[model samples]
Target: MKKLLILVLMLAAAFLIYRFAFKKKRAPREKPVPVAVSEQSAGFNQSMNSILSSYYRMTEGFVNWDTAAVGSAATGLETALKQLNVEELKKDTTIYQTALYPLELAKTNTATIAAGRDWTERRHALNDLSDNIRTLLLTIKYDQAPVYWQECPMAFGEGESGDWLSSKAEIINPYLGNKDPKYGKSMLNCGENKMTIDFTKRDSARLK
Candidate 1:
């Protein structure tokens, strides 16, 4: 009888241990959530490319000396912005607002020249705005930022007069006649002057 009792108790304990210990462990798993790209990041690239391409086309028109075409392109760009609206392009749309000032300055300069007025003042103004925009674009991580006058050969020298080019003969080849017209009939009319900005160097280290 005692043997029978002992056997039953041992069986009960074994059954309990097996029930608890032999249960299968759940497999380790990662959360089943979908990874998605932010709309702002994706759309920013698209909008930036579109706007820049349009700006380049307008610049080409200006370089070719087509004032009417430049104005039309600028107008079309502004229209595109209005139609798309900033919210659709980026979460913080104010960055785009910053670009408008220079774009407007460019348009204004082109318009002044087209109106037969002395565009030197407008050009100077546009230059300032362009520089500012370059800085801003760099800050915002825009792909093509303006190259400083130090980097560009024509900005500081090579005006309508040959004095600067003559003086800086050692640094630059004077024999390479000024391909750019300083006192042009109208760069806008011919669409020949396209502004250039440097995109190769970005100082992301300073951004933090």
Candidate 2:
């Protein structure tokens, strides 16, 4: 009976030692944290959206060949551009440097469009403005809303072309610009959609 008791005690002690000494340690779990938007980035987005909104309105005016409306919209775009935080935008050094040229050109062309006497001249300026704005937007990824890049194959003349950004996927030719008053529907859909900028994915990448 004494020897049996000694063996039982030895077995129990061995089991406890193995359980404590040979057990594998568990890895600590990582908890996910919520993403927070910074004030500067939020302001930057607001400014960019405002610029895009004004540009869209200006494009609409061009489509209707309403010079007064176009001028007004251009003025609004100028204001929006002026309000943008350049220092904030400079956070992305690469984007800031690349965007500067286009941004300045957009400003100059918008001013010209606002003051131009001839409709054709204004349209020409508008084309340049559109290109510059498109480049700037693509570089910075201002908003999370999709903008369509549309191209008119016959904008300047046959075989000549121009492109503009639109809020919708549908093509509305600002280059044609209500040129045919007699045929109200003529040249309204003269362009093809070149690309759709889906900003949701793009803006996320920019944030990262």
Candidate 3:
């Protein structure tokens, strides 16, 4: 009777141990969902492509002295503008209002070599637009910029066609004494420009 009681108590303890200690733990947590690249984003991307294509065609026409080609490309610009969801963009951000001015000007103008010269004027408008677009894309991907900036290398050189894409590449490795990197906070071209960002090193890029 004593042996049977001891055996029963041991079994009960084993059952309790199995129920409490051997139970499965929860799976690890998942990362947060990124913003979707939805139909709207796709449409915006298409419009941007159309605009850039038309601009290129218009410039090519001017270079070749083809007035008809320039006119066709100008018409293409109008089509691209029509595809743009101006009202939707305006609702989301004030950036559209700023971009619309130059776009309107470009649309109404006659095709001429002089029209090509208006690029600088148009660019001021478009640069703001581009900045907004980049911000939107980044927001979609990361929800926000990372708390920590990652370091990567980029190449330093002008384009093959001698376009002044970059005046020069100033690489300030924080590990070294050099300060004030030119590409500042951008991640897009770090590797292309052959400059390594040193996150491990002391930061010297801040303005003194």
The candidate that wins on lDDT is 2
The 0-to-1 C-alpha lDDT of every candidate, in the order given, reads 0.43, 0.82, 0.42
What residue runs in model 1 are displaced by over 4 Å at the alpha carbon?
Answer: 1-40, 80-129, 143-208
TM-score rank order: 2, 1, 3
lDDT of 1 by residue, 1-208 (tens): 9999999999999999988999787898764454333223555545645555554455444345555765566565454434333444244567666655554554453344334333344234334434543443453455432332212234334553211101111222111222346644322122122233345453444443
TM-score between model 1 and native = 0.39
Tens-digit per-residue lDDT, 1-208, candidate 2: 9999999999999999988999777888764444433324777888888999999998888888888889999999999988887766677788779888898899999899999998779888988998898898788764557789999998887899988998888888887866645446588898899887765532233342
Worst 10 residues of 3 by lDDT: 159-168
Pairs in steric clash, model 2: none
- lDDT tens digits by residue: candidate 3, 1-208: 9999999999999999998999888898875544333324556656655665665565345334455765687678667756766555565455555656655554444223225454333323322332333333333222211112212232223321111011125322211111114443342333223222211222233322
Order of candidate numbers by lDDT, starting with the best:
2, 1, 3
TM-score of each: 0.39, 0.74, 0.36
lDDT score of residue 103 within candidate 1? 46
Candidate 2, superposed: residue stretches over 4 Å from native? 1-40, 179-184, 202-208
